[model samples]
Target: MLARRLLIFSRQFVNFTPVIRRQFADSASQTKTVKFISGNKEFIGKGKVGDTLLDVVVNNDLDLDGFGACEGTLACCTCHVILNEKHFEREDRTNPAGEEELDLLDLAPEVSDRSRLGCQIKIMEDDPEVIEVRVPSVTKDQRSA
Candidate 1:
């Protein structure tokens, strides 16, 4: 009985623990620019430490069509992006393209050495203030029934 009670209590603690929120400076003060290579248009996005690239893009209304079609579910490669070489291999970034992410990259149009799913790229505390994103000029119509 005692062991069962302790296990239940531990599970409760784990389930009830609140998720810690990441904070960032105001968007006005620290506006991060997400540049689009195709249109040469730049949108401002403010990202907290844990914010994904998709989060920043959608939150700022950058007007990139066919983006986040899967809403970061990893079900499709709609948010496929090519990161500049400078940022793609940054040593400080905690997120790396895993095998599954790599496999999905093969489905994205114009896959490149620097291709990465925007949803998988999170803004760590030490990430650069300006992140350049390149949307492939062509996107496949991956709509499903």
Candidate 2:
């Protein structure tokens, strides 16, 4: 009798899991727009709240040269982008750059005060600010080459 009761309870919980997951997914999937400047060209990309900047470039099919060479891994700085200093240093920036990312940036060309690895920066759900990003004209990830 106890085994049968447990099976019924488990079935009910399984059936209810999808509703809970859908709600969370909806919030995380909120779209955010970012402006990317690559040399003389400008592109607008849409990304979800939890997506990394690299994800935005790839998903929106933006023509960023050699971006995300490491496929969002911190191993390379190919996804380097120059963000507005204020936005980069925002207290509420979701998934800000960590030690590893900072170290990798040192090796990238055109390193600037505003430079950050796109893979390390995630869009925040509450941030109403439109991000302006600058893609360096030349990107060389020695590790990959």
Candidate 3:
């Protein structure tokens, strides 16, 4: 009986080992690093899967000027960012910006075809290890003005 019990325990342990390793692998891949460029200065931030671009900036204290003025409430365009065509296309395919976000982008100064709201952009598991975003040199906040 003891031998049979040990055999069962060993089987359970063997089955669990691969699951544990896979969990670690998934978590490692889920961490994403982002590069933020404002004017000539660049800042780097790291975030986990499901974290928004604004979350990465705020968590890392990136200090991008006039960023997140609406605290990611989507009421303003302070979190505007620009992504290259390739990255923008990938993100849009996975998580397209809603009409409200697009309307707000229309109000943002320096808007571009590649523009996205940092608050609306979240880090996905399949996203590249390093994502790059550009902050416009000047951001206009009509809400406060």
Candidate 4:
């Protein structure tokens, strides 16, 4: 009957509403804003938690050029980023840098105590810190050349 069809459709829609809202909420919850400062330009990027810092830059199409030349595999150091001291010192950091990352950081020009491969930093979802990354004006393919 027409009434039966209407009731079924209404129930279906009701069931789907939660699913749709949850999808949106899940995606929103995963995303966090991160800042990339270069020279005089400050770029803000929205990145999902669990994604590497380089992923944030590339995903958001920020003005950072020649970044993440290695696609975050740690095979390259082109994604070098200087993390904010306050953010780096957070106890929530995924972990200490590995030998591979340290070795690559050494190759980066103007290396500093806070220098880290963008691919190494995993933006934690629960952490309340606003991520700050500095992309040096120069890199040693510097440009995947």
lDDT computed for candidate 1: 0.67
Q: Which ten residues in a row have the lowest lDDT in candidate 4?
A: 11-20
Off by over 4 Å in 3: 1-29, 139-145
Poorly placed runs, candidate 1 (over 4 Å)? 1-31, 91-93, 139-145
Residue range 1-145, candidate 2, lDDT tens digits = 6774575446435534654466497754577798889777888899866567899999999878578987865679999988876777772254356576789999988999889988766666555657788988855577886
Prediction 2 TM-score vs. true? 0.70
The residue-by-residue lDDT of candidate 1 on 1-145, one tens digit each, is 6774575456434423321222323232233555556545555667654556788878877777778897876667988888887678872254467676787888887888888988877665455676667887754477943
Largest TM-score belongs to which candidate?
Answer: 3
* Cα lDDT listed for each candidate: 0.67, 0.74, 0.81, 0.72
* TM-scores for every predicted model: 0.66, 0.70, 0.73, 0.69
lDDT leader:
3
Clashing pairs in 2: none
Model 3, residue pairs in steric clash:
none
